[model samples]
Target: MAQNVKRRERDTAAAQVIAETFPPNVIDTLLAEAKETGTPIDGVDGLLNQMTKAVLERALRAEMTDHLGYESGDPSGNGSGNSRNGTSVKTVSTRNGPVDIEVPRDRNSTFEPMIVPKRARRIGNLDDTILSLYSRGMTTRDIEAHLREVYGVQASRELISNVTDVVVDEIKTWQSRPLDEVYPIMYVDGIRLRVKDNGVVSTKVAYLAIGVDTDGRKHALGCWIQDSEGAKFWQKVLADLRNRGVRDVLIVCCDGLTGLPDAVTAVFPDSIVQTCVVHVIRNAMRFVSYGDRKAVVKAMKDIYTAPTLEAAELGLAAFDTAFGARYPGAVDVWRHAWAEFIPFLDFPPELRKIVYTTNAIESINFQLRKITKNRGHFPDKDAAMKLLYLGLRNISSQRGGESGTGTHGWKVALNSLVNLFPGRLSF
Candidate 1:
């Protein structure tokens, strides 16, 4: 009798395992139908699509039950103040594709669905997915078709527009937000894009100021789009920056734009405006013949790489004799920018590299260019601002913009700055 009872227990355990492994789940029913009809299970009408729909539907029903305080077919729910109403069908986009799901409703109309909101046309990561594609130079139409073909989700152009439009408020808040009171070095530059102005398409410039604070991390202080680049506009931009915060700036590095030094000096009187050395070299290279280019570039290189101000001056005199007559325009360019250029040379070799070049801001321009490449023209400055802001938002999140750029050797450079200027880079 004991052996018979033990055999029965073993038999029951085996049956239970079989049931758990191959139960009457939605997939089983789907696969059974697929096998009998020999239909593929990866298409829009495939078993996988059906399974996603079923899972999401179950989640929606659960959300509704929680809100209504009863489960389906529960008799206790009848006398409750609010009861389950029939489900409503809504088309939603998923990573897998677009699926039509039934969202449960309540009789009192107070049931707010949290799993999938009533007004949400796209679910899950669809918003982020489309925004990412847009940031990588994909047009709305291209994004729309890509979703349909790759994920089997049909996203209308208007829906895509609305999804991206959500960033406008975020952009406004970020643009007007307060900034760090003191930055060790600031690199300012412009990224140009075509945007609509008063119904006419025009080229607009997005001027961005990137700062390296006391911690060696990179921060984009602000980005502003205007009809064109101008000193008056920049003065206002600088004033706006002052309004937000920025009590003191130790050094401002930039490609020399006429009147920019004055504009920055006006807002930050004590801030030294150091012209970017790389820009001077690139501009100087234009007039030299290909054969003489290397020689001219090397001689010009000697000026900035000099160990002392006297040595740099000697290098400049030598450069004048070698190539000044042949490329007088280039010579004049450097001579004019000499005052601002001299500030960077006063630093230690470690600190000079960080301040003498605009590498940080240039990398940011490359990022902004990719975002604006797909759009022929933005509807207006606000639209352009919104899209560019979203792109910056993504870049900052990826690079931890708040914590600074944290690039290699920056800590060593910051230490050099502190050593060179005693009280400039402290909290």
Candidate 2:
């Protein structure tokens, strides 16, 4: 009984607030009409839909009257150079499905409707709906049919293409935007994409870089397409970064791409290039026998998890001693990457996680794969980049905002880097 009394008091307060918010009898009259006509108060083809159509039409009529400097049916419009010519029926997609309304016209064809512009078939958030679908790998034709089936709106394929094509310009601008002067760490990696070139389908590489800025924010720097991943191409990409205002980078974590370490040294001479520990382990596993794979991984973990650089070197020597005769190639892999592998061991665990691997960009590559998996091959380079740009934007948006600033445990990591690198990092 007491709980029921509290519920009733809450309900009474909400009703009082509603009554004070709207004018007298407005809510009651609308509810009564909805009941009298047996129409829903919300949803598509309901009272709200009817009211939206009515309101839009009435507002349009008011606009027409103002445009002509006279009221509807007023004698002052008789001699006016441009008078009401009647309305033409137009169906536009809206959040509440499609709305069919009559749009006013003028005699001289000079009065343009600002609310619903001429030749506009979509209003409000409908464009956003289409974009959201497109970013998820839906083709233009698929979006057109989806809009028709779900929203009861007939959108042409050309219209959908026009909407998605706008992202091309955005990609161009975002590709060349200036970069921050310093980033504590940057992750670089590449993903394969099938793209059509010269009327033949071929696999291409899309190089991506994700930078963790001063505030520990991760932002996707850029995407570059090439026939294959090579050190020369990476040199050009690094050059582009320098040109874009990246004066200093404390550390760059990347895979064991051949010559990548020398490339980093050439471009940002002060930056430490760390080979991805995860990649090194994975590469080493390929040379191990099926029966001994688990044991090999255990031995490898000791080297990476060691406390200090000297301890890590001892750990690597021990790993080589135990597995050296059985799997020389696996030991060779570690030896080849040893220079790049030892940098993270110098830092504490807080900073070690930031430079341990290229997993930061690897997660992004996974999402881009999911978005592009449906297509057998993109039509062209531009189409692939456009979709990629949109997919990155969508991923960033879902994470809360662009770059998703204030990475978890970032404050602790930043403090460590400041003391370790001294003047390199700017807060």
Candidate 3:
């Protein structure tokens, strides 16, 4: 009964408190001012920050009054142990940019301001604002310039780098985390980033593995920057994936790289390697002569686009007779890669469309390029890796389903995979 009476008293006093705090013309005055200026009254360079400063200052004064048990300018404070000191000037960064405000202080340093606490350099949301920009591929230099021009804040390059460096710990944690046991298809590819290694600056390759689990959701397995591209390094990459908990992979799709098929088999011996036929066609077309290019491209499609491998072989032999004499190097390239190429032919058409090309990985590489294009070269391998990881994180945040789990095209691919491999997949 006592709790009920107290709750009723609080609910009834709420309106009385609001009436005492706000004037009837306050909203009207705001609307009239907005009409006269033709500019926004709330967001970005508006009266919002000024009003916020006024409210915070007022609250600080109230806190001081309560602390002293007397009102401002009252003689009652003479008996109190501590007295009011002059306000201190402090600037804090926020999502709305920077705001300079006066903070109240006490003579004995006993009063700890709560509105803008002591030693609080920035508002909580400001860090997230900086991180959002960094994830969208804005370089630290660009972020510094943006903060200055738009938010009226002078953020040093080091300050901006410091904000992004927080992610390095999260990245380390994510890389070693456990993965799904089985992935129906995995796309492996490398994107180039210019990095300084050991004293010399050169273009280095960063390897990425994108796995599509049974639920049709795509998981970015991991990304790593290697000193050089070699079979030994690739083997280590595969070993790392195995260590993370990838027990079975049905097919690994990749562009033509020397000895990569063997590398896949070395890691998951039962995993089928599907060399991108689209890459083969494009590379072969490069070797064909100009006048013959059109005729050669149409004929080349006949070999891989055929419904059956038997017919594809007949088309392959005809292609050899038709243009193999002139483009013998191209012919040899196809013949050498044929062992890896036929794996796609063995699968049904639904499955073939996926494993026959590295389109999945290529799309991801395109997204990474959007972020790295402005950078000429990173300071080191870790620097390059950080930028790429942020780019991937941003893309996932922007397009994943519900809680940002599955990508857009991945659902369609998973639906097809479900029909093709009914028993081997699990969400």
Candidate 4:
């Protein structure tokens, strides 16, 4: 009898301890202690799971009540209660965790979220990771490994491709968006890429036009892919520019592209087309011997660095006299391109500094090449366009400022133009 009484007392003590340890206040205290100690509680993962489930359930219930005009939980005490349409919720497994999301019901049933709307499934931090990788020029396989190692989540190439495909429509819209009326200066250039065409690989040219508006902000006008670039195709491009709202371009800087000057003249009658002096020099040097290149370059510099058109002409005469026999082709190129080169000289020195070269477009192309460094070659025109568009989009946000010495010179030159053509120039 004595032993039995002792055992009952021991059982009572154990029951009291269990009741005290699991009280609401005790659980709160334990949670605070775990937080302070930076430790996970034993067997608390299940508790966390339950808590998350309950929170999600409550949220879904509220959404259904608000949107479907139906109350959740128990009905009125009467056997029959107000009837309403019921909505179904689905559980979606995601990289972060599992979530219960409500499905939308509409008459059309074709609503697709472009930017990932709320209550979406199979979407989480993975999308952000993929986009970040893409911006940094990571390929699909690289992104797959990165996610596998960082989040212990395996992502397939098709999934990554689909995620990136969301930007295609956006790129199309941006390509067709209306441009500003008057760009103070416009830079035109082409970048070449190897793409598969008709089941055979070939080289294709991608033309890009970048413009700086009157307000000093840079804008990417658009991009086009073609088998080649020439006057006729470029005329179409110019007409497209007009249709897209580019009314006036005061100056256009470009390389020695065939028929380009005529095309520009046809579109913007008042615009001055300046052939890039740097391209002229590069073309000139090709005709000179390696041993005489240094001397030839020195002579070329005199032609560009001359203070006035007459000075430049004198320099050119001297250059032809010195190197004509050795590099007749080089001198002829200069003479042939001189009409385009001399337009900048008609403007003030400040204006000449900006329009004398196509360096602005070249700088942007350099960044583009960096983005395409690892791409051996594109499979098709669409693939090449996609990569270039992504790079442009990433760089587009940084469009608020002038980039180089040329830009500084442009500011001064534009101010002078504004004073000279007050009615024509608008900021």
Q: Count of backbone clashes for each model?
A: 4, 0, 0, 0
User: Candidate 3: global Cα-lDDT?
Assistant: 0.77
> TM-scores for all candidates?
0.86, 0.88, 0.82, 0.75
* Whole-model lDDT, model 2: 0.85
lDDT of each: 0.81, 0.85, 0.77, 0.72
When summed lDDT is taken over every stretch of 10 residues in candidate 1, the lowest stretch is 1-10
Best by lDDT: 2
Rank by TM-score (best first): 2, 1, 3, 4
Candidate 4: misplaced stretches above 4 Å? 1-58, 61-121, 287-294, 399-406, 419-422
- Structure candidate 4, residue pairs in collision: none
Compute the lDDT of residue 38 as modeled in candidate 3: 79
- How far off is residue 116 in model 2, in Å? 1.4
Per residue, candidate 4 scores C-alpha lDDT tens digits across 60-88 of 55554554344545454224333334445
Candidate 3: lDDT of 213?
A: 74
| lDDT score for residue 296 of model 3 | 87
Clashing pairs in 3: none
Candidate 1, residues 308-409: lDDT per residue as tens digits? 888989988899988888988778778888998888778887788687789889988898898788889988887787777777766876676346567567
Q: Ten residues in a row with the worst lDDT in model 3?
A: 401-410
| Ranking of all candidate structures by their lDDT, best first | 2, 1, 3, 4
Tell me the deviation in Å of residue 369 in model 3: 0.9
